[model samples]
Target: MVTLTMDGRKIEAPEGATLLKAANSANIEIPQLCSNEELEHYGACRLCVVEITHKNRTRIVASCIYEVAEGLEVNTRSERVLNVRKLVIELLLARNPRHPSLLKIAEDLGVKKSRFEAEIKGCILCGQCIRTCREVVGVSAIGYEGRGINKRVATPFEESPPDCIACGSCHFVCPVDVIPMKEKDGVRNIWKTDFPLQKCESCGRYFAPVKQLEYFREQYNLPPEQFSKCTHCR
Candidate 1:
């Protein structure tokens, strides 16, 4: 355990814990976006910045990624920090004016409206949905394509690639409610067709994402017999 002082209060945290996690443990309030407990720490939103003083110098760092150190002095709600956070909120509001969570955060920060033009993008490009789909669900169906400001999330070739498992993991991980799952006639749908009941060659039972079975077999070099035992067959 390591002891650190935050906003004039002493707190104990385990080693290798980030300042945001430590604050969360201590019940200290900190505003944030682009953070989910299920995914990795990505300090993209710049909303959790805090002032930290160490070795007689103070600088602003994103609390979500900054590790807590022994004897560290952290100020989560300083005047300068609040001002910067307000600006960050303003920027996000400009981009996502209709986002309910962003609007709530802006209201909490006392921002009435945004000064800049709205940066309207269909997806925020946080990569939470994509990473969760690939890493946790083992489906590399959707991913980021293009580069820089033009980047967007799509299946390979902008077509629903054959590898998509249609597990809805991406839909669940999205924070902005961009990816939506639709059901029609008892079948789930992504961008294109509704999920079909793939009959197992052996068992003849219906299953979801028939294509996923084919991709799995090809990817893992499984024999034809193994393919028959997949959800389609089992």
Candidate 2:
């Protein structure tokens, strides 16, 4: 355990723990976005920046990735930090004027109106949806295409890629709800294809994702002897 002082309060934390994780553990309030326990610490939002002083030198750093060193002094809510955060919020607001989450954050930061015109893009490039789809669902169907300011999440050929399993993991993880789910009759529908699930002749068990034994055989390029292994056919 390592002892660190934050905003004049001493707290004990693990040696290698990031400042944000330790603050969260100690119930210290720190505002942040682009941070999730399920994914890596991206530190893209810059909302959790804190002023840290070590040996009388102070600098601003992202708390989500900054390690808590011993005898360190951290100020989570200094005036300078707040001003920087407000400007960050303002810039983000200018980029995504209609985004509800961004609007809410700006409101919380006490931004009345932006002086600069809004650049207005739907997605914030947080990468939450991409990480969730690739890491959790194991489907690399969608990805960020283009470069720099023109970058966006898109399927291959701007159409649904064949590799997509229609898992809906991307939609679930999106913070701004940029990815639109297919809706029918005011209800969002997941991928539901009507495929025959015949009982395996050998095992007499139902396996829906595999569909019929013959269909699985043809799709998987299995040998004829593998028919007995099919739960529906077995």
Give Cα-based local distance difference scores for all models: 0.80, 0.74
Q: Each candidate: how many clashes?
A: 1, 10
Query: Candidate 2, residue 84: CA error in Å?
Result: 1.5
TM-score for all predictions?
0.82, 0.76
Q: Candidate 2: deviation at residue 227, Å?
A: 19
The digit string of per-residue lDDT tens for model 1 on 12-92 reads: 999999999999999998998777777778887788999999899999999999999999999999988999999998887
Clashing pairs in 1: 200-232
* Model 1 TM-score (2 dp): 0.82
Tens digits of per-residue lDDT, candidate 2, 1-234, equal 999999899999998889999999989988776778888777877888899998888899999989999889999989988888888877777777777777787787787777668887767777887777677666677788898879887777776465565556777777777776664432333333223333455666533323234544676799966755454334
Model 2, 178: alpha-carbon shift in Å? 1.1
**What are the runs in model 1 whose C-alpha is more than 4 Å off?**
197-234
Scored by lDDT, the top model is: 1
